[model samples]
Target: MKKVIVISAHPDDEVLGAGGTILKHSAQGDQVFWLITTNITEPDGFTVEMVSERQEEIKEVEKILGIQKTYLLNYPTMKLDSRIVNEMVPRISEIFKEVEPEIIYCLNRSDAHSDHRYTFDAVMSCTKSFRYSYLKQVLLYECISETEFAPALPEKVFLPNYYVDISNFIEKKLEAMNIYASELGEHPFPRSERNIKALATYRGAIAGVEYAEAFQLIKFIDKE
Candidate 1:
């Protein structure tokens, strides 16, 4: 079975970004791993109850998604920009060595959240072909709120060039995302379930599928 990894800045991002695709991978017998770059903590103004709830949510998501394992860097939430890449890269690289994933799905570099951007940078640093020969493909998945809210600069636009049909898995993806009750909101709020399904429908139109997840192809190495 092929090994796959999904790296996210926070817990709900994997669900928001590529939950359906991950489900597809697991159903196809690919071993899937999750790398969460940040966490909510008491030091970050979150209450003890809030911190505990988020941990529970992560566990629920792992079970629902069939994640083989989860690696949490536990970096301070929303403060990734303040951290040094030097300190981040080695820890992430170690996970790369252990997982040796053939396919990686990570947050878009130009996403609105600084944490997302920084996480992408660190993950990319670990994917150099010379160092991680097992890595065959790397793709950036778009998080609904973060990606759409990014500054509308030409360079920052999320131009999706790849699509994964997720018609059968969309409901399960929504089920997994609902575990993060604190993250979702009503219709107008970007993380709402309605909006999430809408985005999938919109992307499906682009790809001629009933429902799909869109991604930006960053790298693909063919050794054959």
Candidate 2:
């Protein structure tokens, strides 16, 4: 089985960005792993109960998605910037060595959130083909709110060149996302169930599928 990893800036981002694709990999017997870069901590103004509840949500989603394992860096939320890149890269690189994932799905580098952008930078640092020979592909998945809200500069645009048909797993993705009750909101809210499904439907039409997830193929190495 191929090893796959999904790296996100926070807990709900994996679900928001690539949940269906993650389920597809698991169903296909690929060893799927999660790397969450930040956490809600008491120092971040979150109550102890809030931090505990977020952890519980992560566990529930892990069970629902059949994640092989999860690695949490536990960095403070909203504080991941270039200042900590040196500290973050080695820890992430160690996980890359441990997982040896052939495929990686990460947040878009140009996302609106500073956490997402820095997480992407740090993850990419660990993905040099010569250093991580097992890595065959790296793709960036768009988080609804962050991606769409990014500055309208051409270089910052999220141009999706890859699509994964997720018709069979969309409902399950929604199910997993719902575990993060604190993250979702009513319609018009980008992370809402309605908006998530709507984006899938829109992308499905472009791919001529019932439902799908879109991604930008950032890197690919053909070892053969």
Candidate 3:
């Protein structure tokens, strides 16, 4: 079985961005693991105790998505430190020593979010020692919030080089998203589900699939 680890910046990113591929990988006998960098903790709105509850929420969603295992790093959302990247290196180095994934998928470095970009940088930098050993490919995925947006500057539009046909698994994408019931946004749009569906459709249209996911390829070793 091919060992795979998906490092995501926030909750629901894994499902939204790579749900179909994850399902496809696992169904083909790959063991997929998740390394989450954020915890769903709202001390004011949901109370501080919700972290543990959200932990359970993460697990349930992973199960529903048929993921093999998930590890939450509990990094703060939108706020990432440069030092944290160094800190994560050795730890992820250890994980690579153990799981030794054949593929690692992360957010693109040029993404809008700092945390997402930082995660991509750190994940790539840390694994240099294993350059041609364990990790063969590191692909970048687009999340609903992060991926669907046009660049703040006019010239910097997000372009996808490859697309996956997610027509069959879009329902599973929606199903997995339902687990994060506490993730309602402030009332301009209110619920995030509607937004998620719309983004999926949008990316789907861009990718030419009825419902699809998009990715940017970082390393194409054997490609000539």
Candidate 4:
């Protein structure tokens, strides 16, 4: 089984970004780990009950997604940009050293959320050069709302060149997403179940599959 890591700025970002792929990996017997950078429990205007609810939500998601392990850093939510890159990179690097993941998945750089952008930057910094030489491939997945709501600039557009067929795992992805009740909205909302399925169907159409997840490949080091 391959070692895999999915890094996200917050709890549900991974589910929205690449939940089907994570499920597919686990079903294939790969060891999947998650690194969530921020917790919603900060004093940035959230209540204790809300914090407790969000924590419980993630725990349920982990169980449903078959995540082998998780690394949760209690960084402030929605305030990742205020922190310096050096402060974030080392912690992620330490996780890399321990997990030694063969494949790394993270948020795309084009996301509108400041936390998402910062998380992508931090991941890039941590994996630069020979720091994590054992990494074989790196892929960036798009998060709904955050990625699609970005400005119409060409540089910020998410142009995915790779697709992973998730036809068999879309139901599991939707099931896992339902655990994050706080993050979901009505049908018309971007993070709604309808839109999530719609996006997957669109990607699958491009790949000639029933459902799929798309990604931008940042690097691939093949020793063969």
Candidate 5:
């Protein structure tokens, strides 16, 4: 069984980004782990601790995805700087030793969100420098909030090279996101049914798949 890890700066990212891949890999009996890099309990204008509320969202997601093992870095959300990742070098070095993942997925470095970019850099640095990190390739995936047009999708579009048909797992993704009832506060869009389905269909057409999940291929393994 291969060892796989998902690193997300935000909570719901694992599902929105590559939930199908995660499910497919796990169904193959691969050992899966999550490296959640933030504790984003508090938001600026929100009255409740969005961070703490996020834990429940995560729990509900775990039920659908069945990733029993997880790790949270507990660094404050968006507080990570280059210096902090440097400080985390040794800590990540230890995880590298422990997990020794053969394949890895993480946030895209060019994401619009600062936290996603920070986490992406941290994973890249860790993979490059860690003694045990001889990973063949590291793929990049898009989180919901981060992938919505703007800077994340230059030209107001995302062109993905790889797509996993998640039509089967799409319902689970929606179910997982539903657990975040607290954080879905005041969403301009209903968010329950339309956007995600539209994105999956849109990306599927581009990738020539039916009901797909999209990811930006930053690096790839040469199966040769």
Candidate 6:
């Protein structure tokens, strides 16, 4: 089975971007790993108890997703920009070496959040051709609010050309998303259950499936 890694700027991003894909990989017995770069704590208005609760929720999400392992850096939230590329690249590269993932997933560079954008840049740097030799493919998935809410510029838009049919696992994706109690919202909001299904439905329509997740295939190196 293929080894896969989903890297995100925050905890819930993996769910919003690639939850169903993760489930599909796990169900097929492909090893799946999660790499979360930031953490929420007092600075984000989360008390100690809330932080602990959030951690527990992440574990539940991981368990439900059938993630073989998770690497949580717990970097300061929303401040990834302050960190230099050198600082982020090495740590991420280390994980790349350990996992030797054939498939790598991360946020698109055009995402609205600075953290997401910077994380994308760092990941691109870390997985350079000269660095991760085993890496054969890389894809970028869309985060709900952060991806959809980007500025109205052609360059900033998320244009996905790849799609994964998740008709069978949409419910599992929603169940995994719901684990993050603080992140969910009411209908009409980006992270709401209704909106999540709506987005999946919209993407499925593009791919002529009942439900699907869209992605940008950044690179697919076939050396033979």
- Once fitted onto the true fold, the runs of candidate 6 whose alpha carbons sit more than 4 angstroms away are 43-45
Instruction: Decide which is better by lDDT, 3 or 5.
Output: 3
- The clash count of every prediction, one per candidate, is 0, 0, 0, 0, 3, 0
lDDT of 4 by residue, 146-200 (tens): 9988887887688899899999999989898888876799988889999999999
Question: Which regions of candidate 5 deviate over 4 angstroms?
Answer: 41-52, 150-159, 185-192
| Off by more than 4 A, model 1 | none
The 10 consecutive residues of candidate 1 with the worst lDDT sum are 78-87
Kindly provide the TM-score of model 5 when superposed on the true structure, using C-alpha atoms.
Answer: 0.83
CA deviation > 4 Å runs, candidate 2:
none
Question: What's model 2's overall lDDT?
Answer: 0.93
Candidate 3 regions with alpha-carbon error over 4 angstroms: 40-46, 129-132, 150-157, 184-191, 205-208
For candidate 3, lDDT tens digit of each residue in 165-203? 777877777778778766655435534767666666777
- Ten-residue segment with the worst summed lDDT in candidate 3? 182-191
Tell me the tens digit of each residue's lDDT in model 6 across 44-129.
Answer: 78799988988998899889999999998788888887455558888888988999999999998888898998889888987777
lDDT of 2 by residue, 61-178 (tens): 9998889999999999999879887799999999999999999999998899999999998998999987999999999999989999999789878999999999999999999998
Across residues 1-224, which tens digit of lDDT does each residue of candidate 5 receive?
A: 88888888778778778787788777888888888887764444434655556777777777677685788787887788888887666776677678887778888776677878778777877766245435666788866666564374454344567778776777777677667665453445634346767778887887777778777666665552
Of candidate 2, the 10-residue stretch with the lowest lDDT total is 150-159
| lDDT-based ranking | 2, 1, 6, 4, 3, 5
Shift in Å, residue 169, candidate 1: 0.3
Against the correct fold, how does model 2 do in TM-score?
A: 0.98
Error of 1 at 33 (Å): 0.4
Cα error, candidate 2, residue 127 (Å): 1.1
